[model samples]
Target: MSSPQDPYQPGQPGQAPPQPPLPPQQLPGNSGRAFPAPAGTYPEAGPFGLPGQHPPAKNRRKLWIILAGIGGVLLLVVLGIVILINVAGSATNQARGLADGFTKMVIGGQSSQAYDEYLDPALKEQLSKEAFIAGVDTLEMDESCKPTYNDLQVSTDNGVKAADVAGVITCGGKEVDLAYRFEGTEDLKMTNIKLRPKA
Candidate 1:
């Protein structure tokens, strides 16, 4: 029979045949083809290697130590400046105080007190208390004689030096020229004083 007329022929209203499903895709291997690596996997070689790697603890500690030393040096410099300022202030005060004391004793007619304050140990031993007091008393008794000292000016000259003291002596209302020399010690004591009448 003529193949029974193909009972399920397309033209004779028969169901179509089913097609096969597509295969799943796959990445290539190291066989001359590039492929994406799995997440979190890294290449053997890198442009720089492990981003932001920290320095060793020892190296970091050394850097901190160097900075600390520099800071300490700066601190010491500041402290030195403060100490020098204090010393200068103390010197100024001492000079002013000594000058004031001399002025008060002389103007107040306290010749003995003035002598005691101004004379150093050496001078005191050389000149007896009576002689020293007498000399100052003579100056006080003179009508035109007046002794005055401005504030002491201190300066460094190998050591410390006091400014020239101003002195005058008057007799019979005539001014008498007086020459004097003054010296001080580190402790600001008036260590030496000499007076000479002008010719």
Candidate 2:
């Protein structure tokens, strides 16, 4: 049999081969077992990857939904503004039409007819046909008094929508400023009329 210190010692029956010696770095201070080597930097996007930065599929979908919600709100606001503008414009035109019709009557020698047919009920009660005709006549209203309607402005007072139709009426050889204010723009009626000679 080989001696215990023999180089051929492993020739003994059932004896395993000797293990290679660990490196000096592998030694655990006085402890029989060695500690494992320190690990290197983490794998690509491994532990350093935060939750929502490059996010999972589900989180990405949530972000898209939030964007869509904002887009929908903006679309609704634009549509509402367009619709409001159209309604206001229609109201102003309707009120202007009423004022134009009344002005035409006064210019066409039908002041009494206009007062009976177009004036608000409350105003008609306060001013009789004679009084209304007398009012129009004060401007020396005549065929030579050419009326041209200018810009019509709009406003609201006490929940009553109104329009002020401004125009120049040449009367008695003088240019006069004419303002016809109407109320109830929805079902417009002449509320007031005034004529002033321009300076």
Candidate 3:
């Protein structure tokens, strides 16, 4: 006798064989996540060599160094600016002090001393000591006048620094405006002087 009817055999006339289960990708309600591969098998390779691998450690370190260098350069630039500002301010104050001293000496009847010590080479070439003294006597400034400066400024050109100071000197209730230009901060010297009666 023949073997009992094989139920799942293909080409069997009566019954159709059962189908295998569908892959996860084709399954209904699947979230599209792939199944894990067997051990020793790898997933798709990415640009960085592996799917979850990071960039090389050397490259990351280089990036950090570059950023730090930029930060250091910026810090140095800011520090340099601060130092330059301080230097300029110091020079301005020194110039102002020199100007005030010269004015005070001249008003105190020390015109000879003021001219000898404070006059710049350029000014001396233009005005003799006698002429300067004569000019001061013309003003007839009171020896007790106290000078008050209202305008002060400093500038630089071609690596040379100069200061301009304008002030009012009150003598015997009469006010006179005195303006001066001083050159060279290190050894300050009066380059020009203007004395006019206050109107």
Candidate 4:
């Protein structure tokens, strides 16, 4: 008649031994990633909340917008330069056309009209109308001198000011080179003219 020995004691094993502390109780409705894990849980709280988290997504978007704006500005600048070059080229071509038309008129014996219409205003001031008529008459007297179109070249020195046109006129099997400069905004006007006989 002695007190019953504890059944769970090592040598008195008649009752079932305790099952491994019930395998660490998991919090209900949690994926076991909950912060401050439940009491007697296996996982412990790890990292704490950081103050003022960065908006990485928003920052990335802003950076892209800035880059796009810069690119757009550069593109517009390039386009402006191209447009300016085209405009200058057009002006040069127009100047060459004017020179070609004037040369044709003079060679076809319409010297009077050429002298009156194509001469620069400054040149007209230097020579009287009578002198121009006399000079044209002298040129036309060369019956053997057959004038023909040779070549035309156009160039631009100052895009804002004027265009330079070079024209070659073949006469009597020889070449006569001339330079014409044009100025003005909407309607370009002849500003100067120079003639040279090519040997």
Candidate 5:
């Protein structure tokens, strides 16, 4: 018989004694929870518990909206510039047309119409219309009164109301001086005109 202290000596035992089963693992706070493997693949979390890459689409859309707004502003600026240029060009053309018409009327012996168109309202009020027409008609008859105009140079300062015009006129084979003052509009009315015989 085996001694009590030697429960089953290796040499005398028919088989090894059975071992005790291990205790179950305990999770920290939540006892029922199961831990995943450290290297396992899982969805990533981003700021505010949102998916990491989900906001890219929204960010892209916002960027496009901003770009479109910038483009619209640029388009408006370009359109405004175009409008300003066209208005300036139109004003210049109108001044030139008035100059050309005045030259034609004076040179073609249409003194009544020319005087009516060329004189400022104040000047016309000072000189009777009939008297002004008669004077221009007589002047047109003078062999020394043949008038020719050079290119019209038009400019503006404060607006269409403050335009200036200057050009050369040849009368009686002699170059004369001509100038216009815009009064409340760009309709260049003749302000000062003078003629002198060629030296």
Candidate 6:
């Protein structure tokens, strides 16, 4: 029988024998006792990437830059539209003034000056100065009455700007509807003139 202090001694009947304790495992670069891995090693992985790596600062900054670029482009577009509208309005007013001045000069017996200044080069090429003056003379417009314009419309087609002025003027004490078409926003010269006697 084994002594009571023997490590491998069996206990009383129906009891199992005792086994010796296991020796400590010694890894190449570690102490006898194993330690848990460092906190940085073998980081937990998630669907996107490593855990706690969601919403990176670099990606957030890029998103903000993209949004800012879009906003800047939109601002520029709005400013450009505003500038275009103002320019078009200025051109319309200029055209209206030119039409009024030209009509008054012709009816006020300054046909020579009107033909020299207001008529477009293309129109002058079609009608001689003598013919224009003769045509105005036949109208017999009252120089005392002021011409009144009812409507002025400006438009652009294929990069060409044009304006139409429609109004009424007194000729021999009779009201006459007169319409004038002017072309070119910058140069602004008269292209056509029409007179209709009102019944």
Please give each candidate's TM-score: 0.49, 0.63, 0.65, 0.60, 0.55, 0.60
For residues 1-199, write the lDDT of model 3, one tens digit per residue.
2246744667767665687866545665757766665567676787888787877899889999999999999999999999989988888788789878998898888999999999998999999999999988888886778888888888888777888999899887788898999887467688999877889
lDDT of 4 by residue, 82-133 (tens): 9988976776568767877766776667777887777767777887768766
Q: Which stretches of candidate 1 lie over 4 Å from their true place?
A: 1-52, 55-59, 137-189, 195-199
Write candidate 6's Cα lDDT for 87-115 as tens digits.
88987798788988888888788999999
Question: In lDDT terms, how accurate is model 6?
Answer: 0.80
| Candidate that would win on lDDT | 3
Model 5, range 1-199, lDDT digits (tens) per residue? 5766756666665556666642233445647666653455565687747656445578789999999999999999999999989977887677666666765676576767877777677767777768756655544344344344454445665764444556655564455455555454545566544432334
Per-candidate Cα lDDT values, in order, are 0.58, 0.76, 0.84, 0.64, 0.61, 0.80
Scored by Cα lDDT, where does model 3 land? 0.84
Local lDDT at 79 for model 6: 99
- Residue-pair clash count for candidate 2: 0
How far is 128's C-alpha from truth in model 2 (Å)? 1.6
TM-score of 3: 0.65
Candidate 3 lDDT for residue 28: 57
lDDT, residue 152, model 6: 89
After superposition, candidate 4 runs with Cα above 4 Å error: 1-55, 136-160
Ranking by TM-score: 3, 2, 4, 6, 5, 1
List the lowest-lDDT window of 10 residues for candidate 6. Answer: 18-27
After superposing candidate 2, which stretches have Cα over 4 Å from the reference? Answer: 1-55, 143-145, 149-151, 156-159, 171-173
Per-residue lDDT tens digits of candidate 1, residues 16-109? 6545532222443445655555667654654445554455698879999999999999999999999988876676566656655664565467
RMSD of 5: 10.9
Task: Write the number of the candidate with greater lDDT, choosing between 4 and 5.
Answer: 4
lDDT of 5: 0.61
